[model samples]
Target: MKILNLFFIGLLVSISSLASAQSDAEIEKMIVELHKPTKKISDSIGKLMQETKSKIETEIDSVVKENLKLRSDTLFNAFDDNAINELKQDFVFAKKYPNSLAALKLLRRHVNRFIGMNFYDTYVEVFQNFSPEIRNSEKGKEMAQNLQYFKQSKVGSTAPSFSLVDSNGKTISIDDFKGKQYVLIDFWASWCGPCREELPYIKELYKKYHQQGFEIISVAKDDKQDLWKKAIEKEQIESWRHIFTSEDNKNIIKNYNVNGIPHKVLIDKNGIIIGKWKGSGENNKHDLQQLLKSIFEAE
Candidate 1:
C-alpha cells in the first residue's frame, strides 16, 4: 500500500537480510509498534532490534508480492502515471532515509529506476551520501557508472546521428529536421508492450506541437514488419515518420547508447539534444511532459 512497493512488487535483485537502522527512540519505537502482528491492524509484532528491520521489510515485501500475485500484471500496472508517481514517492523515502534498512532495501530493489531518476539531483545525492560500505560496494560502483552515463546523456548533449528508412523506404536522418523543427526521435517496437503503451504520449505531444514546428521520427527495432505496421495502424500513428531498423543498422540504439526501449530523445531546431528519457517510470513521463511544456511555451 506504500511507496516501498517500488523496491518490492516491480523491482529487481535479491533482498539483503537487514537489521533496523538507528532511529530516534520514538521513531524506532513507533516503527516497531506499527508492524507488530496483533488483534489491532496497527499492532507491533515485537521490539525491533538492529536485525529486525531487514526481516520486517522483507516480510512486508513478501506480503505485497503475494497480494499482487502476478509479475506480468505488476509490470503492466507499474508503467502508467499513477505508478510513476508511486515510484517517485518511494524514491523520496529512499533518498530521505538512505541509511534506513527499508531505504537500502528499496534502493537495491529498484536500482535501475533509482539510477533512472538522474533527472532529479536529490536521488544522486542520496547515492553520494550512502554509508561508506554501501557507497563503495559493487552496486555503488555500478551506480557511479550509471550516473556518469546519465550526466553525459543529459539535455544539451549533441544528438547522435544515423541514416535509416521511413515506411515508404525514404532515407531519413536527423539532419533532415535539424534547424527546421523540433524532433522527437522515438526508439520503440511493436512487440514491446510498454513501448506500445507509450504511443499515446507521443501522439499527444505531436498534436500539441506539430503546428508550432514539431516533428517526430520513429526508429522501429522490430524484426517483423507486418506486426510493426499493424501496431502503428492500431495506434493510429499515421502522422509521423516511421523508420525500420535493420539488425545491421541498429545505430539508433548503439549511437544513443540506449539500454532500453521506448526511449525518447528530444532535439531542438538546431539538432541539439534538448532532453532524453528512458524507462516507464513516473519521473520519466514527468520529465518529458515538462520538456514539452518548456519547448512549446518558450519564447
Candidate 2:
C-alpha cells in the first residue's frame, strides 16, 4: 500500500512540472509578440527624427520649417496614442485572464513608465488581482509598496517634504512654500539635452507667472556642483531655489521616484500636488502650458 501511494505522488509531480514548462513556453511566445510592435515603432521614430533633423537644417524657409515641425509633432502624438492603447489592452488582458505569467512579465517591464505616466492605480488593481502566491512574492511586495508612494505623489496628494541646501547654501523645504506660492519642482540634470531644451520655456513661463506667486525650485541629479552652477549661470537661470544631489540630499531622487530627466511636479498654493509630468516632450509641454494658463485665469 505504501509503494502504491508513493507511485501516485510521483506521477502527480511529473504532470505538474510538465504543465509548468508548457505555461512558461506559452508566455515566452506572448512576450515576443508583445515586443514586436514596440521595437518597430521605436525604430521608425528614430529614422523619422533623423530625417526631420536633416530637413530642419537644409530647408531654411520659415513656413516650410513650421509645417515640418507640425508634422513631426503630430507623428509623435499619434505614436503615443497607439502605444498607450496597446498597453491598456495588455492590462485588460491580464485582468480578464488573471494569473497570467505573461501579463505580470509585461507589467514588470513597463511598470516604471506606467508609474511615470500616472497609471499607478490601474497597475496596482491588476497586479493585486493576480494569484496569491505571485502577489506575495518579493517583487510583488516591492511593487505594492511603490504603488503607495505613487498614490502619495498623485494629483491632489500633499507633496513630500524634504530639506536641502540650495546653490547659495540656503536651506529649503516644502514647508517654506506651503500656503505661500504655486511651486514648480523641476527635476533635471545639467547634462540632459531635453532638460536644457525645455529651460527656455520654463523661463518664459516663470516670467509670466512670477508676479502671480509662481515659483520654480529646480532639482538636479548631478554629481558636480561646479558644472551645475556653470550651467545655471551660462543659461541665465533665475536665481531661484535650486537643489543638487550632494552630501545632504543624495537620495532625493529616490524619494520622489524620479525615473527620468526633465520631470516636473506642480504644487498648488495650498501645498497639494496639482500635476506631474516627465520628459521634455510635447505632452508635458502642453500640460505645463495648460496648468499655467489656468492659474493665469484665476489671477
Give TM-scores for every candidate, taking all chains together and pairing residue i with residue i: 0.53, 0.87
Model 2 is weakest, by summed lDDT over 10 consecutive residues, at 109-118
Q: lDDT of all predictions, in order shown?
A: 0.66, 0.79
Worst 10 residues of 1 by lDDT: 41-50
Q: Tens-digit lDDT track for model 2 on 70-181? A: 7777767766766786678677766764555556666666666633365777888888888886677676677677676677777878898888888887889988988888
Best TM-score among the predictions, by candidate number: 2
Shift in Å, residue 27, candidate 2: 0.9
Model 1, span 44-154: residue lDDT tens: 222222234344446557765454334323333443334345445556655665455445444544444434443446557767667777666676676666565555456
For lDDT, the strongest prediction is 2
